[model samples]
Target: MARKSGSSGEKTRAMVEEAATRLIARHGFAAVSMRQIAREVGVQAGALYLYTPDKQSLLKDIMRGHLQHLLESWAAQAPDPDLPAAARLERFVRFHIDYHILRAEKVFISYMELRNLDCDNFAEIERLRRSYEHILEEILISGAAEGVFHHTDTRLTTLAMIAMMTGVSTWYRDDGRLPPDAITTRYVDMAFRLAGGEPLAEAAE
Candidate 1:
């Protein structure tokens, strides 16, 4: 089926994506079906095709959308490039933890459903994922050049920092010991230490 248009079609498409993300996050990609997603969206199975051609496309779109949104959101509020690397790093750490904790379902599906995407889809998603990772990698590189960060390997540090922050989405709860602000503060401190940069004293306040 052709792609959809108009506000109504766009609204339904968003609904389908949301339902698929929720179901896939809960049950795993291999366990979900188009019919199940349709039911979750309150649409008939046949009508679901009007929004997406197949399950793989839906999975690909969901992951792609999540990563794209991540990049765009960061771009909107990212600290100035001329700022000290530590300051920029602090912003990245806080932004990542705060943004992802609220969308745990999308985060879960993005990581867990990669194997279900087709070759092209996988590559596209990987490209988007790498783009987001590169934002942090560049920060580490700048900090290293400025002698502010002392990591052994920027690439490894970048991956580790992202994994550590993203892991918050897996176990974070509204009723947890720390509120989101405190949790983000702690993660920001950890991120700075992981990158071999001392956390700004104010970061803990």
Candidate 2:
């Protein structure tokens, strides 16, 4: 793992988290051991406890980091705040496909390991995710009001969009025939077509 600039404490914690992410993705959370992760980071197994008091805390750290990125990435690149609802929704589809859905392993880890989080940690992660989804849901509803998007259950549409984006992780492979850009483009096209909100050509997959 690459090193980052931080206090010794922070650096160790970062390495610990990254090691766990790689392990959990290659093997489920249940299959991973603190000793294994410590070995990956070239540290004593007991040393990991200094970073995260328990395995559950380590899991929470992983979930929190992933969810924070998910929310922040969407917030950062979202379309113009004042744009028509459908336009915002269209932008969101493109961003989701290109950014969050593009990386297969990271996406896989985010979805599969989330259930491993403790209840309080899981709820916190869910709150962040819920906020992110609510933004898209509002855009869909607004698009419907503006007579640009097909009227449907916004909740269902939002959930479907998330499911579709998350599903890409399952099938997407680095050595796949298509490059990331091409893959995102194809998925963006598919998403709009399925959403019943025909996309502008540039936005089309």
Candidate 3:
């Protein structure tokens, strides 16, 4: 059957994506089916095809959409290139923490669904993932050059910092003892410590 036209089709497509993300996150991508996703979205199974051609496409789109939005969001908050590395590094830590903690489901699926991706899809996602990681790597490199940061290895430090920040999604809760702000602050401090950076206040002087 053909998809509904106009605003209705657009709304269903968005709903399908949201439902798929939620379902895939709860039950690994391999365990989910288009029928299940369609049920969750309150649409017929065939209607899903109108939005995404197949299960793999849905998975790929979800992961790609999440990463693209992440990169764009960071781009908006990205610090001036002229800013000191310490400042830029701090900005990254805070942005990463704030971003991932709020979208736990998307973050979970993004990491957990890679194994389910076909080679070509996996490579594209990996490339985008690396691009995000490279942001931190470059910051670390710049800091080392400015003598504002010190690390044994830029690549290793970048991965460690990202893993640490993204780990918040695993256990953080709205009712948890620490608010997001407090958590972000703590991570920012930890990031500076990891980079051998002076506190932001001290670095500004």
Candidate 4:
């Protein structure tokens, strides 16, 4: 089993990582430092080490947490004996956009600070990310076989869709424009269009 940190240790780690994620997203990882995160977390510089052994370690943990949360969300959203893959595809795509929008900070941080992750850490994150992509790709392929959707390259489309959803986290500000659900719905519409699926209301017409 993974060794868990004490409550205080977990809380401090959360604060520091939250600060790091915000600063790293706003200012590139190259521009942020452990000292800066420590200051933002209201802790002495050296104290940051109590949670993370080092800067590289801290970055790895943050990324791991992001991926872990993602895996959990997928597990929740994907039903057992699920509906048709096309329907599931819509849920997956829409849910992803909603998740990233709701947790924009984590999404932004994952996008920007990925360069900071060491080779092994980066590989693991990519592995989990690809698992998500594969799910979408499989659904699209199934839809293609059923003649309900068309795609020349399932991999390319899946990556493109993920990129589109991630981009939402970059620009979506809760106070700036639409609510998260509306934003997600619009994105789902756009994704359907890109995947060659007509919007439901339009299909009915």
Candidate 5:
């Protein structure tokens, strides 16, 4: 059968994506089924096909959508390209921590479920992932050129910085010892130090 018509179909499609994101994050992709996702969305199994042809496609959509939206969101709020590398680096660190901290589920699945993605899907996702990584790598490179950051390996440092920041999602809680702003500030200071830039004198506070 064909998909539902109009706004209702779009709404269901959003519901499908949301339910799949939640369930896949909780159970892992291979363990999730269309029927389970549909149940989570309060829909019948067949209704799922109306939104996504199959599980693989749905998984692809979920991962791809997440990355695409990430790129777009960053683009929307990305600091001016002409900003000093240190300023850019600080902004990037703060943006990354804030973004991933709030979407821990998506962050978890994006990394954990890579093995389940087919070659083509995996490649595309990797490309997107690399693109996101490059944003920081470029800042590292520029800062190095400007003598603001001293790093022999921008790629290695970029990956390490991202891992450090994204790790906040794994352990941070809203009611934890510090609020999000405090976490962002601390991570920003750490990122500067990691990149071989000096931290603000007051940042240690």
Candidate 6:
């Protein structure tokens, strides 16, 4: 049967992706199947092909889409280029924590499903992932050039800072002791220290 067109098709496609993400995140990519995704989306197994060629493609798309949206969102909300590097870094730390806090599943899939992707698909996802990392690398480089951040290696520091921030998704809870804002503040302070810079006076308070 031909795939439905127009808004219905769009809706089904979105549902397929959502179901795939949720299932893959919960059960692991190797454990998920197209049939399962179709069931979750309330469609026939064959119907999933309308939106994705195969499970690999679905996984790749999910990872790519997540990274692309992440990059786009950070670009939109990033502080002005003229802002001090510390200020920009603060924005990044807060944004990373806040964004990933509510997106634990997506974050889980993006990190844990990489080994499941085929070589080509994995390369593409890695490229997209690297692009997001480069954003932080640039900030670290700028801070170092300004003599504000004193990291010996910008790339290493960038990776460390990102890993530290992204780890929040693993254990965060709305009912957890600290609120999101408090977590962000502490992470921001940690990020500054990781970069060999002191937190701004206001951020320290």
> Could you estimate the TM-score for every candidate?
0.94, 0.87, 0.92, 0.85, 0.94, 0.95
What's the count of clashing pairs in each model shown?
0, 0, 0, 0, 0, 0
Q: Which residue segments of model 4 deviate by more than 4 Å?
A: 1-6, 175-177, 202-205
lDDT of 3 at 60: 91
At residue 101, give the lDDT of candidate 6: 89
Candidate 2: where is the Cα deviation over 4 Å? 1-5, 203-205
Poorest 10 consecutive residues by lDDT, candidate 1: 1-10
lDDT of 3 at 77: 80
RMSD of each: 2.6, 2.7, 3.8, 3.0, 3.3, 3.2
lDDT of each: 0.89, 0.76, 0.87, 0.77, 0.88, 0.88
lDDT of 4 by residue, 1-205 (tens): 0224578777677788788878877787778888999999999998988878887877777777887778777887685434666677778877788777778777767766788888998998889777778877878887787787777778888889889878887788869778877777777777777688766563232
Candidate 5's clash total is: 0
User: Pairing residues by index, what is the TM-score of model 2?
Assistant: 0.87
Predicted candidate 1 versus true structure: per-residue lDDT over 24-93, tens digit per residue: 8889998989999999999999999998889888888888888888898899899999999999999999
Candidate 1: give the clashing pairs: none
Better of 4 and 5 by lDDT: 5
Ranking, TM-score, top scorer first: 6, 1, 5, 3, 2, 4
Model 2 lDDT, residue 98, Cα: 68
Pairs of residues at least 3 apart in sequence or in different chains that clash in candidate 4? none
Q: Candidate 1: misplaced stretches above 4 Å?
A: 1-6
lDDT: which candidate is best?
A: 1
